[model samples]
Target: MSQDIHRITQATLDKLREEHHHLTTVGRTEIARVIEAARSLGDLSENGDYHAAKDEQGKMEARIRQIDTVIRNHEIVERDGEATEVSYASIVAVVYDG
Candidate 1:
C-alpha cells in the first residue's frame, strides 16, 4: 500500500506540530486524571463516567495518531503571494451554479 503525502503550508505544519505536542502532553495528562477520577468511583461495568472517559480517550488517541500520520507524511509547501498558478497550500475561489 502506498501512503499519500499531504501538502500543507509551513505555518499549518507548525500548528499541527504544536497541536500534537499539546495533545500528547497536556491533553493526555488531563485525560488520565479524568480517567483516574472516574475509576475511583468503583464498579467499572456500570460506570457511565468511566465509559464516557474511555470513549473520549479513544477519540483523542485516534486524533493523535492521525496527526502523527499527517506530520510524518506531509510536505511543507511555501506560499507565493504573486503567483498566477495554483500550488499546494494555495487558496482558491470556487463558484457552483446549476
Candidate 2:
C-alpha cells in the first residue's frame, strides 16, 4: 500500500511511456511541419493557416508538458510473491450486476 505509487500496472506504464515517446518525437515533427507550411503562406497577421497551426502547437505543447509531469512524478508499484491481496497496480476482473 504505497501512497506514491501509480494505480496503473507496469504494462500500462510501458504502453503510456511508449506513447509519450511517440508524441514527443513524431508529434513535434508534425507540428513543426504545420508551422512551416503556415509560415510559407505569406502575411502572418491575416493567415488562417498560421492561426490554426499556432492553436495546434499550443495544444500539443500542453500535452507534452502534462506527459512530462506525469513521468517525473510517477512511482512504480511493486508486488510481493507472498502477498495474496491486491493493491495499487493490481489488475482485477469485475462482475457487473447491471
Give Cα-based local distance difference scores for all models.
0.92, 0.78
Per-candidate RMSD vs. true structure?
2.1, 4.5
Candidate 2 lDDT, tens digit per residue, 19-75? 789888998899899999999989999999999989998988888777666666677
Per-residue CA lDDT of model 1 for 1-98, tens digit only, reads 67799888889989999999999999999999999999999999999999999999999999999999999899878879978998876789989997
| Regions more than 4 Å wrong, model 2 | 1-6, 78-98
- Model 1, runs deviating above 4 Å: 93-98
Shift of residue 85 alpha carbon in model 2, Å? 9.3
- RMSD (CA, Å), candidate 1 to true, equals 2.1
Residue pairs clashing, model 2: none
Candidate 1: lDDT of 68? 93
